[model samples]
Target chain A: MTDPVAQPETAIIVLGCPEVPVQQALALYVASGLRERGTDVLVTGNPSVLGLLKVSDPKSVYIGKTLVLETCIGEIVERKRDCTLCIVFAHNDAGIAYAATMCHLLPKSRVVVVVFGKDPEPLAAEINFPCETITEKAVHNPAQLKTKITRVLGWAVSRT
Target chain B: MGCIENLKYEKILPLGASFKECREYVEKNYPEVWYVEPGYKLFDEYIIGLPPIALGIENGEKITFPYTKPCHGTYLLRIEGKEEVERVRKTAKTKKQAGYR
Candidate 1:
């Protein structure tokens, strides 16, 4: 018998920093949306963000695979894993660097950078990649981030 | 980092392009640059500053430390030299690979 075709995977690199609630919410929200679309989602993040995700999504309904920041890079650089979609949450300069690095490693992946906070345009510009971007000032409000994520995901769904 | 304190260190601001390019730029000019991967736990704690680049320096006698920032648009500790530049690329690569943090 012939083997079944494997589902294309989607990787979300939820770049987070200390004291960023909006970023955490957005990451989870986007991951959940991607999961609903029948995409195999891999959520990569730091300890604090992962911890919050675990508490928020204890059932693993939204996020089934949680990887450390290193493993994510290893997947692309070492194992040569490619993704149908790669989302990067960039709120600060460091976040932008991480986004750039991922884009650099996975040249074939469709990478998108999400930016939020005061005057996000400047930061968005810093990403220095030719990919889709979502920028907003939703630092204080998780709801806004959720809305933005939904809209972005809607666009992504239509594209595929 | 604390482990390589015995060597002189410097910061290579704005790694720009890919890690390979950054490394090549530094090595072609500065032949003394070597890389030291930071432990995972240590890396995780430090990258919170969001530093674009950092590096350790060894001037044949003493080694400097590696450091990073959590934010942007601030005064970076001024550093110079090819070794410093290489250090920045190595540090950024390690952090990018989750080898540092």
Candidate 2:
């Protein structure tokens, strides 16, 4: 018999450090892909990031349930929410910190770190969590990130 | 009360050994702060073009961590009166202790 409480099959796309334009586009791109696969998609970020996405996808067509950055972290860490996949987008020092914090918060969830911009390997290494790392050189180009985002989501899907 | 509405804006990137230190400094210095979730500053800065997006402190000290263009990085915006600026600055510097860093 299956357990009465069902594990949350949530696919969280944690986005921060929107220094690069691709960061916003890539986030929406990934969310759309996840939704297509029938996965519960949750996009977590600050008001600034969420506002942009809201304007871009005003109808919430591609974007799913949006959570404030702290609330999302709190829910995941407190075990109030169960997640199967976690993806963090890191562009700078602070972005890495956010990613590391998420990794620490959701230990059981499969975490993936996507490092963009120049010289991402070192930044990715600082995550300090067991996560799959994907680095992209095209920080300004959203198209390139699209391909990579697809590959990453595909990977997340397979693992789940 | 009127002074709160006329506060000047100052942006800071808190330098602390840990995130907790940074948080504590903001809390002590600014009387009112609202923390926006970590990953959402971009929208408030770019799309909304507004203040008080996700502030650490609110009211007299309208502290918001909104993103700027080109990813200059997240900054703490202190919206306080002119007289309070120096006091806040002094507190911000003093909070970073030898061990905290």
Candidate 3:
């Protein structure tokens, strides 16, 4: 019998509220980087965040597929959907909560949390789970976060 | 009694109580209730205090979860009714759904 072809890995990028300026830019950058690695990427967020992302990438060049945040969580909870890797972009306590929740839900999958804002250290400290966490203090400029994300992508690729 | 605006009943946690503290409280006080872990997005608006962590009972008929308002604080809301419970249950992984065997 012939050897079966392996399926590409899948990744879900969970985004927090769209108010933070760096979130949208970092999300797109990460999605693009993941896509370049031949991984299936899905960016999920609230309607407002989705609207902003869609408007930014109207042609869906960087963002391949998008799902509503609640719907995505529902699917995971019901064991209807899953991914090889889950990345959460967080800036506040709520973001930390979301990341912690994702860790519980996807115990088998690798979860990476990208914490950024005025005080990323304190917010990142709130996460008390087993996952790769990246922290940077970037509000309007995506440079710092972008570099950290690039390193994360490299590390992720090396592992898988 | 005057008209009840909603069917939901709530008990707000004391100030400075963390999510872990709230979960411990539920486990100690309401041992029969099973809780979904923190991080489930139960509300439409962005939660500023904590992620929506809920405790389910009565075969998913009655649920008590934490709901936080920006600058207001978090509340342990006890909502009765199967429909609402189902809605909350669908948002995050539960004990059974988490493959507790």
TM-score of each: 0.62, 0.59, 0.70
Quality class of the docking in candidate 1, CAPRI style = incorrect
Q: What tens-digit string does per-residue lDDT give for candidate 2 at A1-160?
A: 2222222367898887556788888898888877766779999887788888999998899997898766676566556876788888887756666666566667788888888877777666655556788887757787766776665555434534
In the order shown, the candidates' DockQ scores are: 0.13, 0.09, 0.16
| Tens-digit lDDT string for candidate 3 (B33-78) | 4444543444332222333354644455666555532122345656
Model 2 TM-score?
Answer: 0.59
Residue B54 alpha-carbon offset, candidate 2, angstroms: 25
- Candidate 1 lDDT score at position B33: 45
Model 1 residue A58 lDDT?
A: 95
| Angstrom error at residue B26, model 1 | 8.7
Give a tens-digit lDDT track for model 1, residues A111-155: 778887766787876655667788887777877667665665564
The sequence of per-residue lDDT tens digits that candidate 3 reaches over residues A1-160 is 3332232399999988877899988899888878876899999877888889999999999988999876677778778889998999887665666677678788898889999888899778777688999999899999977877766567334534
RMSD of 1: 9.3
- For every model in order, the TM-score on chain A comes to 0.83, 0.85, 0.90
Pick by TM-score: 1 or 2, better one: 1
Order by DockQ, highest first? 3, 1, 2
Instruction: Please list the residue runs of candidate 3 whose C-alpha ends up more than 4 Å from where it truly belongs after superposition.
Output: A1-8, A155-160, B1-34, B38-63, B68-75, B82-101
Better of 2 and 3 by lDDT: 3
Candidate 3 local Cα displacement, residue B59, angstroms = 16
Per candidate, the number of residue pairs that clash is: 18, 23, 0
